[model samples]
Target: MKHPSVIIFFLLSYVCCFAQEHTNKEVDSLYKEDQFYAGITYNLLGKIPEDVSQSGFSLGFHLGFIKDMPINKNRNVAIGLGLGFSANSYNQNLLINKDDLGNTTYTVIEDTGTYTKNKFSSHLIELPIEFRWRTSTATDYNFWRIYTGFKLGYVLTHRTKYIGDLGKIRYSNIEDFNNFQYGLTLSAGYNTWNLFLYYALNPIFSSDARLNGSEIDMNAVKIGLIFYIL
Candidate 1:
């Protein structure tokens, strides 16, 4: 027979192993979902001036991470704050030009057939704040969600390009563009497929940026899909 001390040591080791395994099997009661996200959108322009119109398909892409804070005990309702980046392009008949004297000009291209491509693109760093409601549980992966939020963005860079009969014209970091942009956003869906919409509350250009003596007060409207991942 073994000594009593040796037997006690074996018993203690077995108990410790069992406890460790049991702890590993236990699930976390406070789990969060959809903390990381990526999305793509179809961009549209609103409040266009006369003879100004969009042409080709304008696109926007976004990716972000949100800090999910559960408001209630169930963790189904939460507030989310996040930082993200977005790249957007608007393909339209509006032409932006700068002269040698550093003066900028905005023109409406009446003849769409003359230009093969005319577009302005912007890259932004964004801050998103959201009110989120979902039918999700800690163990459930598939659930319905509705998230509404406000997003504020600062332009990191912007460029305008035109390719057509006129010539290949390009401008970078136009000073006339509004450096800050804000919008309302909505995202709703089940599981992985979510519909996303964004409507800008302010114009893309400042009041000083004018077309034919009128302020080119155009806002952006985006509709598309957003995917969230754990």
Candidate 2:
């Protein structure tokens, strides 16, 4: 899930609530610090009609920061948020064919066509704010924490591109992604660092009969390290 937006919203709301309920000094003393981490991860995209080529993996890495605090007087649960960035894309080489009717659509070349790679890469701004429920508390030296939540964000780049038989092409906000950028993130790793999977409830790209559009699937799978400072 690309979640900077959701996390930011939740964080702002949390801060506002905190300011109304407790003193700034008390909030600072309890919140403590934040942590940062970076590592390699894979991006799995459902892909869009930019299908002038074949689709496959374009490797990348992710870097993130996290912060958390307890909820109310009950230390058993914590509210946390994180923001991260991942370099991701899809590469596809397709077979372009022109029909007698002047329609330029692609079909299998029966083992005779060549592969032209259509590559796309973008830096994702992610934010995940979570309400974590812990079963056990950590000692001074050991921290054992588990949490889950949702995230939301928009594609911050020309995240969609075409590099197949057609010349290089890029898309603006108009028809890119579902236009509703949000995904569900479930995670279980460790403190300041954990493995997570983000699932999108909406298609990254749109599907319509008009605009010469094709069905482009754009959900993704990401595995990376997470860190929380507080």
Candidate 3:
């Protein structure tokens, strides 16, 4: 038989090794989820002028990274703050032109048949803040999620193009556009397919942009799908 001290040493060594392995498992369980995302949306105009109407497909593309901060032990509830980029286009009958004095003019095209292409596009850098809740665990890949948030964006570049009887009019960086845009956003769904919506809280154009002596206050609404990745 082995000496009594030798057996005690072996038993002590086994206990220490088991305890260390258990501690490593606990550390590994503290994990985070859903750090990256990408989405596409069908863009719409709201609160538009009486004569203005959408003609073509207006779409938006978005992608971003979010910092997720879980508040509870289960990690099912979290706050997310992210930086994103978005490119959006609005196709409508409202005309954007420049006068002789280099001033901007806004007009509604009564006859849609006159124009082949008329739209304005905007590129923005966005900040999104969300309150996130989900049926997610550290290791679960498929779960339900509901994320509601507010998004603020600053226009990086803007352009207007018209091709028709007007003989191809194009302009860039119109001063009438509001450089800062903000909105409310919601995203919810199960697993890979998620529904997303954004409703603008402010107008796309500044108050100086007027139509028929009234401020042309038009908001934006976006509906689409958003996908999240680990």
Q: Using alpha carbons, what is the TM-score of model 2?
A: 0.59
Error at 40, model 2, angstroms: 4.0
Local accuracy of candidate 1 as per-residue lDDT tens digits, 1-230: 02422443454344334422322234569988778777778999999898988988898877778999999999999999999888888999988988789899988888898989999999899999999999998767778999999999999988899999889999998888999999999999998778999999999999989998999999999999887876
Q: RMSD, each candidate, Å? A: 15.2, 9.2, 16.5
lDDT of 3 by residue, 1-230 (tens): 02422443454344334423312234336666667777778899999888789998987877778898888999999999999888888899999999999999999999999989999998899999999999987656678999999999999989999999989999999999999999999999987678999999999999999999999889989999887765
lDDT per residue for candidate 2 within 86-169, as digits (tens), equals 555555443333357844443332222333445545556778677776543432212455667777765676344554444564
Estimate candidate 2's alpha-carbon lDDT, on a 0 to 1 scale: 0.51
Best by lDDT: 1
Model 1 — TM-score against the truth?
Answer: 0.88
Candidates 1 and 3 compared by lDDT, better number: 1
lDDT of each: 0.86, 0.51, 0.84
Determine which window of 10 residues in candidate 2 has minimal summed lDDT: 106-115
| Candidate 1, position 168, lDDT | 97
- Model 1, CA-based lDDT: 0.86
Q: Candidates sorted by lDDT, descending order?
A: 1, 3, 2
The model with the greater TM-score, 1 or 2, is: 1
- TM-score, one value per model: 0.88, 0.59, 0.87
